[model samples]
Target: MEQSDFYELNDGAKLPAIGLGTVNIQGAKGVNSVLTAIDAGYRLIDTSTNYMNEGMVGEAIRRSTVPREELIISSKLPGAAHDYDKAITMIQESLYRLGIDYFDKYLIHWPLPMQGKYVEAWQALIDAQKFGLIKTIGVSNFLEEHLEKIIDKTGVTPATNQIERHPYFNNNEVVETNKKLGILTEAWSPFGREINDVIEHETIAKIAKKYDKTPTQVIIRWNLQNDVMPIVKSSSLKHQKANLNVFNFELTQEDIQTIDLLDKGEPGRVEGQHPNEYEEFG
Candidate 1:
């Protein structure tokens, strides 16, 4: 990763502009993929307890040539462990699973507002950070209301907010809100999963051609240019390499404007789970 491709969080921690999102890949395959990405110059790895791959990620880190301190490893607290006590225990369990003493970053996987425990969970995260178990703390799938509630209650703002953001569903309002709060916006599913049309979109293709890059590369560059850190997942070494190769070129202002117009608002949300209504817990 280039020195220019990193964002400084509110806590003064630096995060890679692009991270490997370990969602479905598991076991030896996941380990190898992660190792390959690290070898290919990826310094950030994003995983979660819900993803059930922290163990694999840990194994990969152990086997890789990269030192643990050089990599930014992040995990999330699952909705199943929303209470303060459960959140603390779950983070410890995740640390044990990852074979690490401390995480560079930890996040609440989702607000699950209907459960009404995210504020308490946030407090647990704050305590964990104070305990030296986590270096930086943040949240995922949290909206403006969720962010405000937690900050208002604890007087501690999250270091980052990970949310589903792609060209089709940029969620500009949330991104702006995070910016105003000094919270870095980390984009999950930055490529608009299963939406082949985005990769094949005329505007993206045109921009890619102009920059002599792939459409995916164009989109990733767009995220960086917009000050959004994107977590992109790919099991294939080829795709992973391609994803990391995006920093070489710059996206034109007009091209970015064209992609911006692709936003479809609510209908463009790929995950289909609203933060306010998603209350599932184990």
Candidate 2:
């Protein structure tokens, strides 16, 4: 995207359509990986307390030739820090670790609805935004109820909802819900994380062959075409560049439908945890 791409969030903030995900990337290698993404034209970079690499992400920001204001940096609050006081501290701590003044966006990593603290956490995020600690605030892994709970209690809708989405599990229900709410849906594991199960699918392979592109490119494009921002992770520079090169081709509506048809519902979830029951201790 030479002109670069952006999406107008519900909160009237602009966010890049495609972003780099820093999951396993850590330490010096992680720093280099994030730097590579910045150098490769990724304007948005996603990090999280759960990911445990805010320091490296911060270092990459320092080393990048791109101006700090030009890049949109995001991080998340951990499950352990859902309390009002703890959530506020974690937001400040993330900034301290990143050595940045403020985050472009920040999210609650999980709803942890069972604890009934997510709404309370949402209140903390609102306070942080008012304090100018973060430009935008949202949540991850939130189902419909989780989303409504916060919005009902606080009257603040999240700007985005990051979730596990791929061909194997389209999660269209959540996607459409986000759509109606005017919330941008971000796909975390756009490639299914397990890799082979998604990219190697017969349907995706056929479309890839038709476009003369790898299944990876097709997936990223699929996310864009579906109005979903994809946060993809790649350690190699070549793959990072290749991931963003998807703009040249367009998938036919029929192809998009066929791909969506490949959804296996809950059976296709790659990550073992369901958002509702997941109790994150780490």
Candidate 3:
């Protein structure tokens, strides 16, 4: 299996198709997980300051032999860090934590419209990228209108948009719009938040049996087929290895359509703050 399948960003940077998400992983556990993943040939590591595990992630990176250029490290500015100065400082701090000179990608974690500073924060991101603080800049949990607002104001399209996406909430409209705008769609909770019921749905299980794969494998494969970067989280070494085992099998076009019918067109998890009620944090 290819350890590093590539996905093209709007800016033309190619990201590894799969990443190990470090949300909620912390302390020694986090450090070990990241080291283990890197040692296993995983090139992408996703973490956030809010995850509060960048220090451990940094430690793991230092302990590994992979050079900085070979790793794609992605972090985000938390909602409270939306102010320009604070956002810039937070990013620098994150780099310090990760023991890296610059991030492979940095994102506005969410658009808090009530705070009314994300546009400025977005500008900060652009400037940071220009300064080479990060190689790519993007956002997370931003819907279409929020994305359009930033593009209109700054004329800088986000390189990608990471969102809660899975079979149950495909968000194809958003994906299509992102394609039109040259932004890549990234799936944060690619397994439907461990809602294993989706895995057991008759259609999925039937297809899985046919393919000799698990329901989880089917979902990840579906994401790859749809051209979305799928971030799968796992603390267990066994499941971590299992998650990456998605490359050998292929989901047919018919299987893809069956999964497509699972879209409920509703928000699944981590939908961003409403524009009117956005809050500030630092």
Q: What is the C-alpha lDDT of each candidate?
A: 0.90, 0.91, 0.83
Ranked by TM-score, top first: 2, 1, 3
lDDT of 1 by residue, 1-282 (tens): 353557889999999878889999899999999999998888989999988899999999999998899999999999889889999999999999999999999999999877789999999999999999999999998899999999999999999999888999988899999999999999988888877588888888988998899999998888888899889999888999899888678877888899999999888887556677766655
Residue 103 C-alpha lDDT in model 1 = 95
Q: Model 3: per-residue lDDT, tens digit, 1-282? A: 255668877788989878889888999978888877877667888899988898988888888899878999999999888888998999998998888899999889878776677898999999999989999999987888889999999999999998777888777888888888888888887776656467678888898899888887888889888888888887777777777888888888888998998887644433443334446455
- Candidate 1 regions exceeding 4 Å error are 1-4
lDDT (10s digit) by residue, model 2, range 26-140: 9999999888888888989999988889999999889989999999999998989999999999999999999999999999998887887999899999999999999999999
What is the Å distance of residue 91 in model 3 from its true position? 0.8
Candidates in order, TM-scores: namely: 0.97, 0.97, 0.92
Query: In candidate 1, which residue pairs get closer than 3 Å at backbone N, Cα or C atoms, i.e. clash?
Result: none
Error of 1 at 235 (Å): 1.0
What TM-score would you give candidate 3 relative to the actual structure? 0.92
